[model samples]
Target: MSKVKLFSYWRSSCSYRVRIALNLKAIPHEYVTINLVKDGGEQKKDHFLKINPFGFIPSLEVNGDNNQKSIIFESLAIIDYLENINPEPSLYPKDLIDRANAIAITESINSGIQPLQNLFVLAEIENLGGNKDQWAKQLITKKFKSLENIMTKTAGKYCIGDTITIADVFLVPQVYNAYRYGVDMSQYPTIERVNKLLEEHEAFKAAHPSVQPDAPKQ
Candidate 1:
């Protein structure tokens, strides 16, 4: 296999999802850790910028037919790319409608909720004299409840169904962040259950921040 390298920071939910997908697909890859906080972050380094100009973590590369191919940037894109290649475990439902619904929920969190609550966004809110704590609560609760409503219709044992899918990939990490910031999960049982189940899975266990290649020395 050609070299498949992942540039990521362990704590990043986006990075976590890509790592979980890679493991679940049984793909071997070299993980290059990016310290998002150290030395002004490896992501900002000139050498890394050539790989991912956006200065974001979790940019995946693999040798392609022509050259080194950049597969995905954001966490959501990375999971989608995995579904495209290793359809076996079937992270996305194969049927058209089911697939669309599956993708919709995944996108729901990836785009609808996550973007508004990331560190950068939260920090920006704080800088603007916005009530950072309340802003977090407001955005997170609204989205969490919205996702719970959506999950009521779409979820099985996992996010999309009894089977694990790309939805789980988004759900697990986002919930982790939510919890870190004290987002009350008891109000959303389905989401709570899904996260509980994913935690027991080996792929997610292995891909956790502490075990990541570039996790801080502390």
Candidate 2:
């Protein structure tokens, strides 16, 4: 079996999600840092563009036994691929309703919120003379409120039940982003609680942005 290669930025939330999944599944992979902030974004380079036409971070390169290599882009899609290939530490519930619920929660954060405040979007906002911090704060706060309400019914030690799921993978990164932009976490008790609990997990700790190989020195 050839090694898996993960292209990621240290502080990117999407990248963080994939790291958590990889760690949880105990899949060993090479970590390649694509500094999104350096040199007008290294992700836009030709080589990276070939891997992912969209030039996004967290493009996963999977090498097969036959030596063939394939790349997967998009955080959720890459995570789903990992889950499919590795079923042991299952990240989804067996029941149909529960599985769908987990996906719903994951999408709410991955699609509904994360995109709006991504680096590119924030950069665009700043280029247009908008206050990027204020923009992120408002958007994250609004989405977190909705997330808090949904989590009230869905959580149990972790989001969607006792065991961790893809929802938890999706949640922690967004919660980190919320706090980074100064969005008060106190308003979302369930999210805060779940995040606090999940933070103690080894996989979560291993995947934290601060500890990544490419994380900037403080």
Candidate 3:
């Protein structure tokens, strides 16, 4: 087995997704907390930037056989690598059409919703005299409406079918962000219903932001 280390922040949605994937795969790893907000964002510092030029949270360092080291950035890429290495208890569906649907849901949240309300983007909005909170809430609500529609058709016990897949992996964190921005989840019944079930699952519960080592004590 490879030695894995995850560079993460407690409340980062992207980081949260990777954590769930690791837990679901039962991959042993070291968690290194990089406080995203402290000291003007630790992820932006030179040392961390050296690890990931994008200065993003959820960087995965894998030390495989022969001591060769590789770093992976971006939540989806990290999850895909983990899925590839640990194919059992797969995070993707076997059916090609089902897999495509799962990927569609994942990318919808990854590229469509997440980036719009990211910290940097919200900060930029604030600097432009825009209401960041309102902006985030509106954007999340709009996207979630679409997600609800998609999930309504594809969902079973999980995002694609009875089995958990990449769709559920992406859904959980984005829904977390939706709650953070005060987006009313009731309107998206399908999303809210599936997220409720995922939240209770052991792997998802273990990877929640509030339970992370770096989470602020309440």
Best by TM-score: 3
Q: Give stretches of model 3 more than 4 Å off.
A: none
Model 3 scores worst on lDDT over the 10 consecutive residues at 63-72
Residue lDDT tens for model 2, 1-218:
45689999989999999999999999889999998988899999998888778897899999755777888889988998898788869999998988998999999998999999998899999999999999999999998988899999989999998989999999999999998999999999999999999999999999999999999888
Query: Judged by lDDT against the true structure, how good is candidate 3?
Result: 0.92
User: Candidate 1 — what's its lDDT?
Assistant: 0.82
Cα RMSD for predicted model 2: 1.3
Which residue pairs show backbone clashes in model 1?
A: none
**Among all candidates shown, the one with the greatest lDDT:** 3
> Who is ahead in lDDT, 1 or 3?
3
TM-score for predicted model 1 compared with the true structure:
0.91
Residue-level lDDT of model 3, residues 117-215, one tens digit each, is 999999999999999999999999998888889989999988998999988998999999999999999999889889999999999999999999999
> Native-vs-model 2 lDDT?
0.92
Off by over 4 Å in 1: 67-71, 216-218
Give the Cα error of residue 76 in candidate 1, in Å. 2.9
Q: Would you list the clashing residue pairs of candidate 3? A: none
